[model samples]
Target chain A: MTRDRIGALFFLAVSIAYGLMSLDIRVPPFASEGFTARSLPLALSAAGTLIAFLMLVLPQKDGPGVEPAGRFLAGLGGFDWPRIAGLALNMLAYGFLLTRVGFLVSTILFLIVGYRLLGERRWHVLLLASVPVVVVFWAILTQLLDIFLGSALGRWGQLLAAQFSGGA
Target chain B: MLDGILTGLSTALTPTNLAMVFIGCFAGTFIGMLPGLGPISAIALMIPITYGFDPATGMILMAGVYYGAIFGGSTSSILINAPGVAGTVATSFDGYPMARKGLAGKALAIAAYASFSGGTIAAIFLLIAAPALASVALSFQSPDYFALMVLGLTAVSAFAGRGNFLKAMMMTVVGLMLAMIGSDPVVGMPRLNFGRVDLLDGISFLLLAMATFALSEALMTVLKREKISDAARAATQGRMGSLKLSGAEVKEMAPVVARSSVLGFFIGVLPGAGATIASFLAYGMERNFARGAKKEEFGKGSIRGLAAPETANNAAASGSFVPLLTLGIPGSGTTAVMLGALISYGVDPGPTLFTERPEVFWSVILSMYFGNVILLILNLPLIPYIARLLTLPSNLLVPLVLFFSLIGVYLVSFNNFDIYMMVIVAVVAVMLRLFDYPMAPMILGFILGDLMERNLRRSITLNDGSISFLWERPITLTILVITAVIVALPLVGFFRQRRRLAQAGEGG
Candidate 1:
C-alpha cells in the first residue's frame, strides 16, 4: 500500500477501537445532563471511521510534496531511525533517572548523554554546556522562583533525616 | 474604551512589563531562528516560565514572543533561504535574492520596518475592531458558541489546502477523540482512562503542546539529519551591505505595505487563515499590482516583493489575535497555543475578558504597539548578531531543545508519566507528520474540542435534547451557513476540476 493508504488503515483501526471503547463509558444515575460523556466520543469515532473509510476507498490523491506512488516502507526507510531511536531511549532513561537521582544530577546526565548522542565529542563543550545549564536552571527553580523540585531519593533522604532526629 | 486604553497603557508601561517585552522578543528571536522551531514551539517553551506571572504580563510576554518569532523567521528566510517558519517561505523568494545581491542588511531592515508597519496598522485595526466584536459576542449563547466553534474547525479543514481536506478532517476528528480521553468535562467521570489514576485528569495541554510541537519538531530535525549549511554560516558572519533604504524604494513599498496590511489583517481574522496564507496572498497581490519592469523584478530582489509578505505576515499575526481575544476562538495554531496558555492562567479569553479584566485585553493590544517598535529598533540592529544563531550546530541545539521540552513538562507536574507520555505522543506525532498530515488542525481541534463539546451539550440541553438550536437563532444559523459554504466551496471546486479533466481526457 501507498503511504497514505497505510495511514488510513491505521486510523480506521483506531477509530473502530475508540468507537468500541466509547460504549464502556458509564454515566452516573444522578447525572442528569442531556449529553453524556460518551456523546462526543461516539460521534467523533463515527466521523473518524467514515473519514478513514473514505480515504481508504477513494483514489489515492497526492498532496503537494507527497508523491502519489511512494511506498510506505520506502518513505520510512530514508529516515535516520537509529539516531531517533537513540534519542527516544535517552529521553525515556532521563525520565526514569529523574526521580531516582535528584533533578540536578538527572538533568546534567540527560544533557551530557543528549549532546554525546548527537555527535558532540569535546569534553569541555559537553561539560560547560550541561553543568552550567543544570546549575542555573536549578538555582532559578529553587532560589529565584521559589519552586521546589523534589526527587524520590530526596524524599528518602528527608525521611532518613527525620527518623535520625527522632521525629516521626 | 478610553479608560480601558489608559488601563492598558499603565500596565504595559510598567518597568516589569517593559522588560518582559524585551526578554520575550529576544528569546523568541533566538528560538525562532532555529530551523524547525517556529512561533508555536517558542511560545510552548515559554508557558512553564509564565506560570507564576500575572495574566497581562504573561500575555504581554507571549505577544512579544509571537511578533519576535515571525521577525526571526524572516531573518533566517532572508539570510539562508531556509524559512524558519512557514509564513516566511514567500519572504525567502525575494529576500534570499536580495541577500545574494549583497543587501542582506537592507533586506533585514526592510523586513523589520515592514513588519513594524504591518503590526502597527493591524494593531490600530485591532484597537477598533476588538471592542466592537467583544460587545457583539457578549450576546453569544451556547448555540452561537457551538456554531462558531464548528465554523472555526470547519474553516481550518477547508483551508487545509488542496488534497489535505480529508487529512485535516481526520486529524481534527482524532483531536476530538483525544480530547474525550480524560474525564468528562460535565460530570467529572472518567471515560477512556482504562483505570489509570493519571488518566483521570485527562491530558495536560502543556504536555500535549510540548510533545507535539517542541519535542516532535526537535526529533524530526534529527531524523531528517538537518544541519546548518556552511554557506548559511558564512552568510551570517559575512559583511552585510547597507541598512539604509533610498527614498524611491520607500515610496515604492508604501502602497504595497498599506495594501498588504489590509489584506493580511482581514485574512488573519478568518478562522484557519493565518500568516502563511496572508504572506503568500500579499506576495501574489503585489505581483499582480506591479507594472512593467517592476512586475518582472519580483522573486529577483524586488523591494516590494520582500516588503509585502513581511508586512502582511506581521499584520496577519496581529489579525489572528482578534478571533482569540474577542470570540475565544483561535484563528491559527500559534494563537491556539496562546489560547491554551490563557486558559491555564485562569483567565478565560472571550467577551468577558474585556469587561472582567480589561488590563489583560488592552495591555496585550498595547504591547503589540511596543512589540512592533522593539522589533524595528531593537532587532533591526541585532540582526547580524541574532543571525549568528543560525550557525549553532543542530547536534547541540536539537538535544538542548529535547531536554527543554522534556523538562518543561516534567517541571509542571513533577510526574515521570508525563515525560513518558510526552515521548510517546511525540513519536506518534512524528509518524503522523511523516504521512503528510498537518499537525495544526489537530492542535486546533484539541484546543477547541472541550469548549465545542460543552457548548454543544448546553445547546442540546437548553433545546430539550433536540439539536434544533443549530438553526434556531439567527447568529447560530448564520455561522453554520457560513461554515457549510466554506466546506462546500472547496469540495465543489475539486469535483468540478476533476470533471473537466475527465471530459478533456475523453475528448482526446
Candidate 2:
C-alpha cells in the first residue's frame, strides 16, 4: 500500500480503539453543568475516523508515485531500515538503562551507541564527545536544578536495607 | 500607553532579565545557524531551562530567541546557500551569488542591518497595535473565544504545506485526543490514563513538546542522513571581506527595507501566514517594483533582492506575535510552541493578559527591541565565528540533541516513565512526519484543546445545553462561518482536481 493508505488505516485503527476506550470514561455526579469528560474524546475520535476514511479514498497527488502491492512490500528493503531500527532500539535501551544505571552512565552509553549507528568510526571521538555532554547535562540538571538521578543499584540497596532492618 | 512602556523598560532593564535576553538571543542565533534546527526547535530546547525563572523573565528570553533565530537563519543562507530555516530560503537567491562574488561580508552585513531595521520597526508597530487589539478582545465571551480558537485551529490548514489538509486535520484531532489523557479538567475524574498512576496528572506539555520538536527532529536527521557538505562547510571559512555597506547601497536599500517591513508585518498579523510567506511576497514585490538594471539583477546578487527578504522575514517574525499576545492565537509554529510555554508558566496569553499581567506583556515587547540590537552587534563582527557552528557534524549533534531532550523531559517530573513516553511520542511524530503530515496543527490543537473544550462546554451550559447557541450569537456565527469557508475551500479544490483528472482520463 501507499504511504497515505498506510496512514489512513493506522489512524482508522487508532480512532476506533480510542473511541471504544472513551466509552468507559466515568463522569462524576456533582460535576459542573456542561459537557462531560467523554464528550470531547468521543467527538474527536469520531471526527478522526471520518477524516481517516476520507484519506483512504482520496488519491495522493504528491510524493513518490504509488507502486504495485508487491513493490510496496519490497520497498521496505530499498531504504536504510537497519539504521532506523537500530536508532529506535537504541532509544528504548537508553530508557531502560537510565533507571537501571544512572543518568551519566546511561547517557554516555546511549551516545556512544548512537554515534556508531550513525557511522561514527573513531572510538576516541565518540568518547570525547559523549562523556562531556553527559557530564554537562548531569551538572546542570542535578546540581543546578536539583533533580535526582535515580539508579537501580540505589533502589536495590534501599530494599536490602529495609529487609535487614525488618528482620532485626 | 506611555506608562506601560516605562513599566516594560524598567522590567526588561533589570540585571537578570537583561542577562536572560542576551543569553536567549545568543543561543537562538547560534542554534539557528546550525542546519536542521529552526526557530521552533530552538525555542523548544530552551524551554526546560526557563522553568526556574519568573513568567516575565521567561517570556523575555523566549521572545529574544524567537527573533534571534530569524537573524541567524540568514547567515547560513548567505554563506552556503542552504537556508538554516524555511523563512530564509528566499535570502539564498541573491545572497549565495554575492558570496560567490566574494561579497559575502557585505551580504551578511546587509542582512543583519535589514533584519534589525525590520525588527525594530515591527516592535514599534506591535507597541501601538497590541494594546488596541487587546482592548477589543477584552469584551469577548466564552462563545466568541470558542469560535476564535476554532478559527485558529482551522487556519493552520492554510500553512499545512502542499495539499495535506486532511492529514493536518487528522493530526489535530489526534492532538485533541492526546490532550484528553489526564483527569478531566471540568469534572476532576481521570480519563484515558489506561490505569497508569503516573498519567493521572496527564502527560506533561514539556515532554510532548520535546518529543515532537526536538527528539523527533533528531531521529529524522539520523533516518534521512541529513548532513552539511564539506564544500559548504569550507565556504563558511576564509577572511570575510569588508563588513561595511557603501553609503549609496544603504541609501538605495532603505526604501525597500521600509516597504517590505510594513508588508511583512501585515502578513504576519494574519493567522497561518508566517515569515516564509511574508519573505517570499516581499521578495516578489521588490522584484516587480525594481526598474532597469536592478530588475535584471534580482537573482544575480542584487542588494535589494537580499535585503527585501531579510527585512520582511524578521518583520514578519515580530508581527506574528500580535495575535498570540493580544488574542491568544499563534500565527505560526514557533509561536505555537511559545504559546505552550506561556501556558506552562501560568501566564495565560489573552486580552486579559494585558490588564492582568502587564509586566509580562510589556517586558516581552520591550525585550524584542533589545534582542534585535543584540543580534545586529553579534552578527556583524562575529559572523566568522558563528558560521563555524554550521560545520558541526550531524552525527555528533544528533546524540547531543537526544541527550538534552532526554534529560530535559526526565528533569520535569523526575519520572522514568515520562522519558519512556517521550521516546514513544518522538517515534510516532517521526513516523507521521515521514508521511508529509504537518506537526504545527497538532501542537496548536494540543495547546488549545483544553481551552476549546472548556469554552464550548461553558457556552452550551449558558444556553441550557442548546447547540443552536453557537449560531445565535453574532460574533460566534461570523467567526464560525469564516472557519467553515477556510476549511471547505481546500476540500472544494480537491474535488475539482479529481473531476478534472477524471475528465482527462476519459479524453486520453
Candidate 3:
C-alpha cells in the first residue's frame, strides 16, 4: 500500500480496535458499568473506518495532476524508517533510564547524539550544550516548579548539593 | 481607548512587569528571529520560572514572551533571509530583497510600523470580536459544542491540505484517531490503555508537537544543505536610522495596511487558517487593489509590498485568538500551543473566563498592547545590531537551540523522560523537515486528536447511536456548507485555470 494508503489502513485498524475497546468499558449508572470505557474507541472506530475507506476507495478525481500525485502518494509511504527507528529507540531508552541516569546525562547524551545524527557540527558545541541544559533544567525542576521531577534519587543529589554548597 | 490603553500601559509599567516584559522582549526577539523556535518554546521555557508569580503577573509575563517572539520572528526574515517562524516565510521575499538593495533601515522601520499597525488593529479586533464570539458561544447547547469541535477538526482538513484535499482529510482523520489513544473520558475506563499506567493519559500533545514540528524540522534540516547566508551583513551599517514614516510612503501604503488588516483578521479568526494563508491572501488583495501599473512593484521591494504580509501575519496572529479565548476552539498549531499554555496555567478558556475571570480575559488583551510596544521599540533600533546574529555559525547555533529545546522540555516535567523524549523527537522532527511532510497537521493532530474523538462519541451517544444528529443541526449544516465550499475551492481553481487555458488556445 502507498503511504497514504498505509496511513489510512493503520488508522482504520486502530479505530476499529479502539471502538471494540471502548465498548468493553465499565461505567456508572448504565445497566452495567462494564461497557463505559469502550464508547470513545467505538466512536473513533466509526470515524476512522469511514475516513480510511474514503482514503482507500475514493479516486480523488482532482489531484495535482496524475504523475506528481502518484509519486507524492507513493513517496509518502517511503518514510526514512532507519532514522525514525533511531529516534524511537532513543526515546524508549531515555524513558527507561529516566530516574536512574539523572536528567543531565540522559538529556544531553540524547540531544547531542541526535544533533550529530541530524547534521550538526563541532565537538565543542555538543559538549557545551550538554552542561547548561543540565544545570538550567535542574534549576527549573527542583528549584522552581511543581512538575513531576523525580527526586526518588534526591538523597544522592548530595554530591550535586555539596558541589553547590562548598562541600557541605 | 486612550483610557484603556493608558491603564494597560500603567499596568505593564510596574517594576517587575517592566523587567519581565524587557526580559521577554529581548528573549522573544532573538528566539523569534530564529525561524523555527517560537513563542510556545518561549512560554514553555518560562513556565517553570513563573511558578513563583501571582497569576495575573505570571500571565502577563508569558503574554509578553508570546507576543514578543512573534514580532521578533519577523526581524530575521527581513534581514537574514530566514523566516524565524513558518508564518514569517512570506515576509522574507520582499524583506530580504529590500535588505539586499541597501534599504535595511527602511525595511526595518516599515516592518516595525507594520507590526504595530497590524498588532494594534488585531488587538482591537480581538478586544471587540472575542467577547462577541464568546457571547454567541454562551447560548450553545452540548449539541452545539460537539458540532463546533467537529467544525474545528474539519477546518484542519480544509486549511492544511490545499491542492490535495482528500490527503488533508485523510491526515485529519488519522489525527483524530491518534487522539483516541488512552482512557475514555466519560466512562473513566481504559479503552486503549492496554493495562499500562503510562498509556492511561495517552501521548503527551507536547511530545507529539515536538515530534511533528520541532523534531520534524530538525530532521528535514539534515537532508537540506543550507549555508546560512546573511547577505545583508555588509549592507546594514552600524546603527539603525530613523523610525519616522515618510508622508509619501504613508499615503501610498495607508490603503494597503487597512485592507490587509481586515483581510488578515477575517482569515485569522477562522479556526484552521494561519498567517501564511492570510499573508498570501492579503498580498493578493493588495495586488487586486493596486493601481493598473503598480502591480509590478510587488516582489521588487515596494514598501507596500513589504507591508502587506507583515501587516497581515501579525494581524492574523492576534486575530487567531478569537475562537481560542472566547469559544475554547483553537484555529491553528500556534494557538493550539497557546491553549496548552493556558491549560498548563490552570486557566480553561471558555465562557467562564468572561463570566467569572474577566481579569484573565481583559488582562491578556492588555498584555498584547504592552508586548507590541516592547517589540516595536526593541526591534527597530536593534535591527542592525540583531542582524549580526545571522553571522553566528550554525555549528554553534544549532546545538544551542537543541540545548534550549532540551532544557525547555525537561523543565516542563522534570522527568528525565521528557528530556529524552524531546531529544529523540527533535531528531525526528529535524528529519521530517528534511523531507516534504508538513509538520503543522501532525501538531494539529496531536492537539485536537482527543477532543475530536470525545466530541464525535458524545454527539453520537446523545443521539442514541444515530448519525442523523450530525446532519440535523443547523450550525452543523452551516459548517458542512463551509466545508463543502472549501473542498470545492481547489477544483474551482483547477477548472477556472483550465478555462483560461482554453480561451488562450482559442485566441491563438
TM-score of the second chain, each candidate in turn, equals 0.99, 0.96, 0.87
Candidate 1 lDDT, A1-168, residue by residue in tens: 667787888999999999999989999987545678887898999999999998888765545333543555676788999888999999998898787667888788888888988899999999998899889988888899998888434554556677988864
- Residue-wise lDDT of candidate 3 within A18-77, one digit each (tens)? 666666655556534222445445655687678667767644334333334357656545
The order by descending lDDT is 1, 2, 3
TM-score of each: 0.97, 0.93, 0.82
Compare the candidates by TM-score and give the number of the best one.
Answer: 1
> Under CAPRI classification, how is model 2 graded?
medium
Worst 10 residues of 1 chain B by lDDT: B225-234
**Between candidates 1 and 3, the lDDT winner:** 1
Evaluate every candidate with DockQ and list the scores.
Answer: 0.73, 0.61, 0.31
- How do the residues B1-508 of candidate 1 rate in per-residue lDDT, one tens digit apiece? 9999999999999999999999989988888788799999999999999999999999999999999899999998999888889999999999999999999999999999899999999999999999999999999998999999989998899888887889999998888788888899887888899899987888888898899999999999889888875767889877799999999989988999999999999999999999999999999999999999999999999999999999999999999999999999999989999999999999988999999999999999999999999988999998898888788788888888998898888888989999999999999999888888988888899999999999898888788888887777899999999999998997788788889989999999
Error of 3 at B323 (Å): 0.9
List the candidate 3 regions with Cα displacement exceeding 4 Å.
A1-36, A56-98, A104-133, A136-168, B1-14, B38-59, B229-245, B412-437, B449-508
Please report the TM-score between candidate 2 and the true structure.
0.93
**Cα deviation of B428, candidate 3, in Å:** 6.5
Q: Rank the candidates by TM-score, best first.
A: 1, 2, 3
Q: Model 2 chain B, poorest ten-residue lDDT window?
A: B223-232
Q: In candidate 1, how many Å is residue B243 off?
A: 0.4
